[model samples]
Target: MQIFRQKHLEAVYRRAAEMGPDVARSVELQMLITPKAMGIFKPGIEVIAPVLSTSRKEAKEAVRFIDDSPIRHLASITTPLIPMRTSHMSLVANVTHFPPDVRWCTDNIWIDAPVNNVLPGLKHIADTMPPAPNHSLRLNWQPAASRPDMAFSLESNNYLAVYGAWTRPKYDHKYENWAT
Candidate 1:
């Protein structure tokens, strides 16, 4: 019977890998394997109570300080077995007693996040100009974190942002795109 249970769990794991994390997480919630006896979700919840408390806060202040934290010291080691961080933090090692790689993509994969991945930016311009003779506009753009050229570019022939009066014809304007 135990062997059959383990096989079922293995099948669930395979389903999680192929179907996605949400489906995998919901796999056979009725039956949970434990040493004491086959129990329900409530006992499992008690096994890692501290992790459940972290949901009270908005920012994840509890997670970063969870390991060796004065309040939830034991929870850091108990988190991995609970399957809470399996979606994103599975590969990111810190307090959990797990490997760098959890062997599956647990979270949404960004195709254009890598340095070599070239994702073309999209920009749009209004067809009809707003009826204003002064041609004044307000811009509320902040400094770019990584690519200044992408956020505030001087070249208009090809760009990821809409070209306005500020960057009209020859890039000559009262203020530079970078606010120089």
Candidate 2:
């Protein structure tokens, strides 16, 4: 079984290589094989237990934090398994762990990815988005801790952020035909 799984993964890597180096070079592909294949596992199984006492003020404070977090976004989905840090932490060392590169065309492959992935930035944007009231959240601080001090310094030096603007592009009426 183990050998079959390994061969299957290798075939995937070979296919990815045929598409181009970008797919083969992705961090997700690199961590194909390892004991902790998926990522870090947090064991937190909730069960019936005695209720703990809490003050109204404390509860309100907790609520405030909850109202300002990413957990609210996760609750909208069925199963949420977010990783703290992927390649940065070397969680998946071998690039072959990622899906096989299946090319659809010369310019773009079915699973083409940028040589240097920007998924971390995309995830950061999602986490930083303001949460709605009465929603729950869980802040993952691992990335913050590992980030370089220069990143913080840059905020004061050359800060860059979007404000009072729509993150998405305006809808085009010309695409109405495609909606059908």
Candidate 3:
């Protein structure tokens, strides 16, 4: 994991604080655009998912579960959001880093699951297993966002944290264009 400099973290927090409580509690999950969607990978399609966890250990476990499950085919890639202090308010900061202005919420995993399988899979997962360690896995789904453009405009606009992905072989080629 890349350690964010103190100044950068403070900036993010400062901006987040200005959004107020409703926005902070409302923002959850991170948005993702696949390499193909961004025109980086040929023959790939855009897929999005809520951020499962900021914790590397927990995120890895969720990915492992997906890789070992039948739904693995629906998942394209799992990426990390810029790490932030784990707090409800920080969710606002986390989401400030995506595009397409929108506000809604859902507890269901929102990755690239096909329309046909999404509901059934969500039901099955809800019925069979407890929530993930971070409690990210849930049945009731709601997404929220107010001012998303602030994410791209941040002084340290490194939202995706692509540098920390270097250890994951699957993401190696996908993020070449994002190299600093």
The C-alpha stretches of model 2 lying farther than 4 A from their native spots are: 1-4, 24-28, 34-83, 86-180
lDDT of 2 by residue, 62-154 (tens): 223223333333221122222234353343322322222311111111223332342343234333332111011111111222446674432
Q: 116-137, model 1: which lDDT tens digit per residue? A: 2212111011112111111111
Q: Each prediction's TM-score against the native?
A: 0.16, 0.18, 0.22
Better of 1 and 3 by TM-score: 3
Question: CA lDDT of 167 in candidate 3?
Answer: 27
In model 3, pairs of residues that clash are: 104-143, 105-141, 105-142, 105-143, 106-141, 106-142, 106-143, 107-140, 107-141
Q: Point to the candidate with the largest TM-score.
A: 3
After aligning candidate 2 to the native by TM-score, how far in Å is the CA of 51 from where it should be?
41
Question: Deviation in angstroms for 157 in model 2?
Answer: 36
Models ranked on TM-score: 3, 2, 1
> Whose lDDT is greatest here?
3
- State each model's CA lDDT, in order: 0.23, 0.23, 0.29
TM-score of 2: 0.18
Clash number for each model = 0, 9, 9
